[model samples]
Target: MIERDEAAIYVDGLTKTFGSGKNAVTAVEDVSFAVAPGEVIGLLGPNGAGKTTLLKSILGLVLPDEGEVRIQGSDVYDRPQQAYEHVDAMLEGARNDYWRLTVQENLRYFAAIHGQNPAVVADRHKSLLERLDLDKKADTAVRDLSRGMKQKVSLASVLAGDVSVVFLDEPTLGLDVESSLKLQQELVRLTEERGLTLVLSSHNMDVIEEICDRVVIMSGGHIVANDTVEALIADFERQGYRITVRDIDDVVLADLRERFRMTSIEQTNRKTRFEIAADSATFYRLTDVMEHHEIDIDSIETVQPDLAEAFVELTKSSESSMKPNTIEKGDGD
Candidate 1:
């Protein structure tokens, strides 16, 4: 049996590499992090960054070549079933119900398998359907529900059971705006009211930032950033500013180019736009120079790179810096 702890999920030194020698692919490498009970963690990465592999490893769906995954306190690989007793997972397109079964029938079926009384399961099925806005479709066949409705039914199937830890892999993938918003709100409710430990993997940064308390970023099979949203954003905040001026003269433009890494500059008939990096003192010096030259300044929109942009920039830099030899090397035992 696993010991209960404040943290609901913990993965340490987890690694997974498929094949060997020439054909080997390192899917995930030395990934480690913790999700406290009642917390939501967003596993964010680009395509082929090992997000799905990490989730699969945690779910015991895929055996890792190295390291360990723990749900609550039980080692997932060691205890297997027992370790995941409290966990419930929804892969991208897993449909639990028999297609011929009605939504109500499906829930009843799963609850029965979970050892719940038929009457209680029936009540739960009704309640979940109502809560998820699936009440009208409860008697409809599983195969007939819309994609959004099917996703809801699948989620309800998991929530109806006694499981406390939920793993959602791109739960809102391809969902329309209204449906996605509803699901996102429900996910937040699960953590806030039900104290559910939710680990979500998605390519959507907005979704991740909206729901997750912490974020773990993966790139090239390695965990590049793991921290709270605020901390991660602050990590990249290195005194950047946007400057808008009434005009872009050669002297002013030359001065700016010489002082900082100017990411962008836009010149129009009435104004110029610039995204530049500079410290506080440097900002003051810049303004002082503009004033000395009788330059009229317009409004500025100082923008900082958000989590999505930061993640992209960091991973691209890391990927570009990898040596050819390293890329050529295979993942081996």
Candidate 2:
């Protein structure tokens, strides 16, 4: 874990609530996390899990009721200007860019707002355009570009200045597979070349698994899990398996269902197929049960767990165990 003083972004015991009394909804509660310089952090949660609220609070868009945020060791509340001087965000994906401005003009406009002279960062802008495959459309108005192109333009505009920290929400919402792959590559390159710190939120688990150095999962306005993608998956002890067997009767099926978690059961003539999630010992117990019943095991295949599976299991477990809070319906996420 990065120390608060050395972190590129630090959020300490932050909490935010909406409305009052019984109608109040707690968006974030005592959440604390730090991002190291040049590290790519993935923020994941179901809708209404307070991901947007947390991001807004960090960016000073929504004032928190308690706690504090800092950027590069500068307090955001006490030194707003200094703290945010090196920060940029591409929230709302393509909508973050101005429709009236040409692509290059948008970059210049964003850079100028960040206290950067466009001429001084001209090479940087050019490199961004070339790397994102937007060089040809640099002179075209954003409104006239395709959706994928527009999304890339939004990202480029965010990195137009000499900023070191960035927040991106659904950065690849409307892109083709090739375009998404290209954008991912460029983002990794920029992080390596410029030491950029990124906080990205997306429903695309594949993207997160491929790019993120660490993942922070939130459920019910609380941080439930934080770790590397590989670690998270490895820590999930329940292994999934697809098994096919023969001569299994209803009594055996009922016994299996009662004894283990099973799903996707299909039966055809003398053969039966089912999927199950269990630990290694439990799996051995299952095999023993089958042997006792004289069931013939036709096939067994291990299903490897990935980030999506880990996210589902973690969030589901968290949601199930969470006590109900006074959260109003239709409040900000």
lDDT of each: 0.77, 0.89
Model 2 scores a C-alpha lDDT of 0.89
Instruction: Report the C-alpha lDDT of model 2 over 133-192, residue by residue, as the tens digit.
Output: 999999999999988888899999999988999999989989899988988898888888
Segments of candidate 2 deviating more than 4 angstroms: 244-258, 262-274, 288-298, 326-333
Each candidate's TM vs. the true structure?
Answer: 0.79, 0.88
Which whole-number lDDT from 0 to 100 does residue 121 have in model 1?
Answer: 62
lDDT of 1 by residue, 1-333 (tens): 113354688888888878789777778878878888888888877677777778888888889999978888888888977887778777875565577998887787766666677686677577668778889988899899888778887878777776679988878766788878888888887678789988888777888888888888877777788888878877777667787888668886788688766767888787888876566787788888778878878776667667775677667776886533223133110
CA RMSD per model (angstroms): 4.8, 2.9
Each prediction's number of clashing residue pairs: 0, 0
How many Å off is the CA of 71 in candidate 2? 0.8
